[model samples]
Target: MSLLISFSHLISRTFLLDFLYLFSVQIAQQVKLNKEFFSLDPATGLDGKIYGLPLYGGTDALFYNPKLFEEAGLDPNKPPKTWAELQEYAKKLTKPEKGQYGMGIYGKTVHAVRIMHYMSNAGANGDILRLNRKKNNSWDILVNSPASLKAWQYLRKFVDDKSIPPNTVELTYPDLISLFAQGKVAMLTTGPWGIATIKAANPNIEFRVALHPTPDGKPPKLRTAPLITVISKRSKNPNEAYTFLKYLTIQIGAEMAGKGYGVLTQTAANTPQVKNNPMMKVFADQQKYAYFSAQELLLAEWLKCKDQAWGPAWEGMLMGSVSPKEAVNQAAKRIKEILGDKGNLIYPVK
Candidate 1:
């Protein structure tokens, strides 16, 4: 019953621990982390050294009501592949007169980050943010770019057209899940965790998870959030802790995958339970294109901007206080102020 290991969320915060710098180097000299999608995640390792292991990850996917689709005259088996098709599907499925909206979007508040990132999958590269590798790897705010504007404009269309539920303005993930489960909304963006929650809430509902629709009819490059487990720098037994972590991530991880948890290693994902599970298969397939947020590595300062600046900007757009362009531009201004001279601008400053 000794405390050999401690599990912590948000491995990014490990950057704040002074002793972890030394601990990371020690771990790198001894072992390697589980390496599935490691290349795609810029946040891997602490300051160019191995530190923690990604235990689980979450990527947003479209969950739709097959009954609603059939009712709307759309094929229940085939989900929308493009943004245009999604819109048409929403329009056909919407029954505002009957108190049902076709889609559930978190228009305003901090959840806007998820919605905006989902839009990025539809071709909003470098919009909200992107790494400027050419400029010493500085973070660039791309809110005012054409790609960003197009994405937000589409969201505005959904808001203006009433395709999204009336309660969507400040909707969090739980709210959207509840709405979808209660049959108030037909479509939503959620991760694999949502499937079980939806079933628990409404077992009779027929729903399926699909890749989020893109604007160009191609597979979208969506953002992924991973649950990483880091070893404590002040651990009493660092070696034992590492051994336990390695086992958890590589061995037990497979077992967890079958139960619908995101695993860090490919071998874990290849387990019969995971491979056979339908919903997990969709998430596994999408892992190839998943990328982590830069904010994951930047931690506190970036998160501050997300909450204080970006959230309000998106809220303004959703509430009709500003146009899409104005909302995004305002966000960019606030972010630039937060980063100040620290970040290099890839997009031209307006």
Candidate 2:
């Protein structure tokens, strides 16, 4: 019986039922895992049944170039702890004449995820579309909430101040990574995976990682995406598959982390491979305040909303064609239309 390991993003309700089997309760109890990963399981509809084991995935954090910080006369050891400080530091780091920008802003089509990080830092609890677990897991369309408005407006300041690239709206994640590696951008908000990418891009670059700055300089609630491993229902040897899964996740989890993959378990994070690495350490520490976004509940709807609704609105605001409030309102209206009768919608008060 061959065990199938899938890393695709097509894990849906039908995919879960037709392809995967729930892990036995005894198998679950044998190993300790982070509780947050459980919420990311696609088998959420199955009450109290474990279907997947989270292996590794990225978590958001602030990555900065220490050389740029020193050149700007800012302390290389002290990264921004609040939004205000970030802005101040960005201004100092901006050297427009040299073709350098202070920060890299994601204004591309899939920018919603990065925008949600700002919303989370501004006290939206790390989600613009929140799942009200108290209301039977109903959806709350908080895209136009006060916190969200503040977040959008804050991003606009970067554009207005000319602290980001001129082609920000066209820049994708990889573009930003390339810019950061080339030392064209002083600061970036990315994940642990960036450590390896940056090094591979420029082996001599000097960089450091820090927690995402919040409004009040407190610890922030941010987003994470964990890769999970599930058993194929068609497998003839479930026990054999379980053994391999355990060995992959438990025994060699730290080795994976050392290779710049994500650290899924505390034991792996505590290992010298992760703990001693300055960049990876910051991301591992950030996991304590990280969460999987509520949008995961209805991923298809959320992706559609990004394509047709919020994505456009967000870009329009950054492009100066729309006000932040107007953009948020427009996004909320369209999202409500897209998600009609799917989950409970909480519109902003007029």
Give model 1 RMSD, 1 decimal. Answer: 3.4
Instruction: Estimate TM-scores for all models.
Output: 0.86, 0.86
Candidate 2: the clashing residue pairs are none
- Model 1's alpha-carbon lDDT is 0.70
CA displacement after TM-score superposition, residue 280 of candidate 1 (Å) = 1.3
Error of 1 at 222 (Å): 1.7
Candidate 1: 10-residue stretch with minimal lDDT: 1-10
Worst 10 residues of 2 by lDDT: 36-45
Once fitted onto the true fold, the runs of candidate 2 whose alpha carbons sit more than 4 angstroms away are: 1-8, 11-50, 124-126, 132-138, 233-236
TM-score of 1: 0.86
Clash pairs detected, candidate 1: 127-142
- Report the C-alpha displacement of residue 135, candidate 2, in angstroms: 5.7
Residue-wise C-alpha lDDT for candidate 2, range 1-350, written one tens digit per residue: 33334333443343433344342333455454445332343333233345566676667788999899998899989999999999989988989999899989877847676778889777643345765556664567888888888898998899988999988888888889999999999999877778888888899888899988989899877776666566655567877877887777755766877777776667677889888888778777777777665365334466677778888888888788989899988888887887776555465634
